[model samples]
Target: MGLAYIFLTSSWWQSAFNFLSLWLLDVPVNAYVTLFIVNGFIAPAILCWLYSFAMLLYEKIKNKILIPSIILFGAYEVLLIILLVFQPSLVGTVGENYIVSRSILTLIFTIVAILIALITGCILSYDALRSTVPEIKWKGRFLLIAFIFLTIGAILDSFSWTAIFLVIFIKIILIISVMSYYLGFFLPAKLADVLIKDIQ
Candidate 1:
């Protein structure tokens, strides 16, 4: 996911991609427009990340729905990849820093992707929060916060905001999301103990 951001937003990576496209395809790729191709991959990356969180939650609760959810998400990701490969233009167009989806198909896909993340987060957090186990509850708290931040950041990022401050703020929120997600799943035992003790 970080790599996707780097390639999509970083000027250096954009330049590299442009150069590659020009050399390979014998035409200059619009650096911003090229983000259409890059954005397609981002959705799949997000789904994969969400899946990891779901898997961890499943380990704690042993939910039967996780399997079906995985299959559905996998199919959705494959559909995105297929669309990207065959009809990238139908996905969307980028102007400045924001994207304007080209067709209803792309818009619907984007909405579905967001909903998938939200539903997964809600399920994991709700179940974990209900657990009598303190550790599970703590992880759930972080996961909930992470998802909230991520959703807000992603929405804000989709806009072509001219304000520099807005862009910075969005990036900060996204960074927080990543950090919170990491802690949710891989928190250190000692730190977790200390925090749980304080809360208790």
Candidate 2:
């Protein structure tokens, strides 16, 4: 779990590197391109997380969802690999310096992949909240709550539901997610120990 936590925090490293690249190195990487590269670190972290979710789900339902999860995981790997390999041609708009999906088909595929991941991600979070161990259980709850908000925001954003109220709602959800995610890390040491314990 401790190791998993460290890997989960890999995004922090990506952010740090991106920060340095843009500010200190004066490398004007396109924001989207930088984001694409940064997200590379999340796959492993999320995989560990899905394992946590699938474990709980299996215990409850006796269904072998892990196989599907593993298959989805493989597909995710292939998608990213294909994206990276073909990025020069796959994404890039005229007058744009970095990658952005240039084709409607690619864009559709990207959106579908992301939404599928998000749905499974939420499942993983809910499993965390329901774990038998009390100490780290709230960690899962916090993430669950945050993801609820995030999912709402994402849905709203995806549909171009940009009415003033909806926009504000999304912003509020973003704020809640930020608070909730950080709150999970600030638990009592005993709880932290439970939360950080490896799942395997």
lDDT tens readout by residue for model 1, 1-200: 23423222321233356668778997767633564554555555554545465456555653454556567656765776676678666656555433233446655655565556667777878888898999888888987888788777766655456677886797788778778777777778997899899997
**Candidate 2 Cα outliers beyond 4 Å, as residue runs:** 1-17, 30-35, 38-45, 60-63, 87-141, 152-175, 182-200
lDDT of 2 by residue, 1-200 (tens): 23433443342243355557778888755544544443444455556655655565555642465567567656765776576567644432323322222344334543453465457656766666677876557777776675566555544533333256865676676668656665554557765666667542
Record all residue pairs in model 2 with backbone atoms less than 3 Å apart, i.e. clashing: 1-197, 1-198
Return the TM-score for each candidate structure. Answer: 0.66, 0.51
| Candidate 1 deviation (Cα RMSD) | 5.8
User: In candidate 1, how many Å is residue 70 off?
Assistant: 7.9
Winning model by TM-score: 1
lDDT of 1 at 98: 36
Q: lDDT per model, in order?
A: 0.62, 0.53
Candidate 1 global CA lDDT score: 0.62
Decoy 2 TM-score against native: 0.51
